[model samples]
Target: MTLTRQVVSFSVIGVCSGALTLVIYVMARDWWSPVVANLVALTAATLFNTEANRRLTFGTPRRRGLAHVQSAVLFAAHYALTSCALLGLGVLVPAPSRTLELTVLLTATLVGTVGRFLLLRGWVFKKAA
Candidate 1:
């Protein structure tokens, strides 16, 4: 697929997954800590994101197992980035509001999204040559 198409598709999937993450985080936060809630949210979103990107963005749904493993690595990186942002916000604000926390996370996710796209295109979903 062309880079333009890939980007658009990936963005669409990412937006949907991000919304899912936020919804899950909000619900989970009522029962658990922010970190734990974030973890649960990311885990669920990652699974959906990886599969959607494989089929819709990259069109490489043939190797499901390998794609998932590779995406898991990507997920770990994203989780680290987002988690660090949240932690840093906590350190800075002491007791941040939900809006603040979500803002920080959204910013981190946006930054990570660029790297994720590159990795997905050049690494995870690279066409065999």
Candidate 2:
């Protein structure tokens, strides 16, 4: 697939994943700490994102195991990025509103998405020689 197509697909998947993450995080937050909720959200979204990217974005449906393993590593990085954003928000504003927390998370996720696209293209889903 062309680079443009790959980017567009990745972005579309990312938006869906972001929405999923937000929904899960919001729902899970009622029962768990923010960090734990974030972890749960990220875990689910990352799995969805990885599978979607494997078949749709990169057009590589084989090697599901490797894809998931690599995606797990990426998931860890994303989790750290978003969790730090939430933690920093708490530090900056003790009692921040839910809207504010979501804003920070979305911003952090957006930044992370760019790097993710690069890694997905160049590393995880790259064609073997």
Candidate 3:
């Protein structure tokens, strides 16, 4: 697929995956700390996003073992960013509301999405130019 098409496909999948993450976060928010909730939600979403991006965004037919490693790395990177954001928010607000936490999560996720796509295109699912 063309690069443009791949981006569109990724965006589509991302929207779905992001919503899933948000739902999971909301569900677990009361029971868990924001960091823990974000980790759990993103872990599930990352699993789905990795495979979907592999097949749909990059259109690769063969499985590469490195893909799993790449996905794990991506998730770690994402988690770190969101975790830091949450930590910063806590420091700034002292006691943030759920809405604020959700807002930070969404913003952090967007930043991570951009980085994730770059890594997927340039490294994880690299194709001949």
Clashes per model (N, Cα, C within 3 A):
0, 0, 0
Write down the worst ten-residue block by lDDT for model 2: 60-69
Off by over 4 Å in 1: none
lDDT of 2 by residue, 5-123 (tens): 99899989999999999999999988987889899998999999999999999998569999899888888898899999999998999999888988998999999999989998889
Local accuracy of candidate 3 as per-residue lDDT tens digits, 1-129: 888998899999999999999999999897999899999999999989999998889977557567878889989999999999999999999999999999999999999899999999888998756
Give the Cα error of residue 91 in candidate 3, in Å: 0.5
| Residue pairs in collision within model 2 | none
Per-candidate Cα lDDT values, in order, are 0.92, 0.91, 0.91
Top lDDT model: 1
Residue-level lDDT of model 1, residues 66-122, one tens digit each, is 999998899899999999999899899998999998899889999999999999899
Listed in order, each prediction's TM-score against the native is 0.97, 0.97, 0.95
The CA lDDT at 19 in model 3 is 98
